[model samples]
Target: MTNEFVLEAITREFPESVLLHSEPYGFLTLEVKKQDIKKIIHYLQDSSLEINFLTDICGIHYPEFQEKELGVIYHLHNMMTNFRIRLKVFMPRENAEVDSLTELYAGANWMERETFDFYGIKFKGHPDLRVILNDPEMGYHPMLKEYKLEDGTRTDKDDKMFGR
Candidate 1:
């Protein structure tokens, strides 16, 4: 439907959770409070909008950005009408725990894992939370702005280090 209709429904149904609404790039984006994510998801699922496809959920970290310290970006699609919406939940670096959407969407399984793997945003109640790409011993996330490469050098030690 229209962005105004969606915004009105969301604001009326969930006054506390819906933080902001924007129509950028001709798509409706709802900035939701992290704590009320489950409620919002349930509403979306039950609404006529039929946003059944959870296209992607990824994490973003902005060490210098002022608006938010960390963010979890969620993109959902309504396959019936081919409409889409993006929801972003902002969190501080110190307290970054948004309710897991896995219960609502099974496809969120690997998406959440990948977000955790790169941005270190923990997904509570995740069935199997582990490193998807990086070595288990790698403590720091390589995607973060603070991540540093070792002296910008490509030495033989690098090739031999991981047994490549």
Candidate 2:
């Protein structure tokens, strides 16, 4: 179906859960309440829309956003129609946890782990939530904006050469 139709369907079904909606480059994008992510996703997958494919799940960091510092981005696809939709949920860095989609989509297990490994976003009820890429000893999430871009102590490299 058309982006307008999907947007209208989602907004109508979860009026309170949807915080914002947009169509960026003709792609339907929605910013939803963190607590209602699972419910919203379930509806999209099981309802008449049939957006059943969980294309991707990733984490994002926006240090300047105050309470909405940490977020999760979910990309869903309707393979039959080749349609896609994106959903985002944000929360305070201190409470970067959301419901796990593994129970609904088995493929979500590794995606959740990877998001957690990079952004430190916790997926509640994730069966084996742990660092999937980084060393377990690495206590911090490298993808966070708090990390510096370069090693300040390095003497062999010059910032000017890199056009920094």
Candidate 3:
């Protein structure tokens, strides 16, 4: 099956759930509503399209977007066909929560935890949701845009080590 076949299948299944569709780097990327993410992904996993592999799941932070400040990105692959597609569901930072995919894919457990540990995006109904990498005392999501990327106050020189 070709990429267009995959896109057509999704658009046909959930006409309204899809917010945007784009092909960048020849990869089909879809922006879908947060509420429909579970349904959409469940469909992709079971439908005749056979997009059954949960290749990766991650989170993104766009602090300036307000309503779309936080997002969860899912990469799916059809192992037999070697076709891959990406889906994203975004929501406001205040309500950075979505349905858990553990019910559908066991691998989602660690990926969700890592996303939560870094971006603070909560996966509702997850059996265990806690920090996997950072210390619980860290208190904030380090990947969020609210934090600075670099410290300008550094006086100690390490330029050579960084190839600067």
Candidate 4:
């Protein structure tokens, strides 16, 4: 029902799986082990918590964090109470793969595909994990911080006007 209650229940269920918990912007946010995300999600959905709605899913890339080079963010909502929660899982770039939520929420398919397209974080066990927005031949994740926001050879763009 409340953030504290939900967090307690989760912690009680899988204490080791939870890494961190926060209430940013007045919503429950939890960072858990990427490997245990599917189990946690399954509990949240089927347990009394009943976080049934998968609002959104996205990815993030932090090249500077050696072990946490890539991350996936999942938003779940309880329609009955309008309560929301965010779950995050991070992994290294070399092993940037996590269990798919498609089995729990069908809507996770496109979201997972888009995340894979942008961040190259593979969602293992997804039915059809492929590039949903980017060209397959691109062969690189575009959302990673390693890519430059502006090309050095771009003379056509005015940096002063854009506050760059």
Which candidate should be chosen as best, given TM-score against the real structure?
Answer: 2
Higher-scoring candidate on lDDT, 2 or 4: 2
User: For candidate 4, lDDT tens digit of each residue in 57-85?
Assistant: 99987778889989999999999988899
What's model 1's TM-score?
0.86
Model 1 lDDT per residue over 44-151, tens place:
888876777899999988777645788999998888878788899988888877778888999898999888888888888988888888887989777776644444
Backbone clash numbers for all candidates listed = 0, 0, 0, 0
Scanning candidate 2 in windows of ten residues, the lowest lDDT window is 155-164
Q: What is the TM-score of each candidate against the true structure?
A: 0.86, 0.92, 0.91, 0.92
Off by over 4 Å in 3: 155-164
Can you give the lDDT of residue 12 in candidate 1?
A: 88
TM-score-based ranking, best first? Answer: 2, 4, 3, 1
Find the 10 residues in a row with the least total lDDT in model 1. 155-164
Q: List the residue pairs that clash in candidate 2.
A: none
Error of 3 at 123 (Å): 0.5
Candidate 3 clash pair list: none
Reference-based lDDT, each prediction: 0.82, 0.93, 0.91, 0.91
Candidate 2 yields a Cα-based lDDT of 0.93
Over the stretch 40-140, how does candidate 3's per-residue lDDT look in tens digits? 99999899988999999999987778999999999999999898999999999889999999999999999999999999999999999999999999999
- Encode model 2's per-residue lDDT on 48-116: one tens digit a residue: 889999999999988889799999999999999999999999999999999999999999999999999
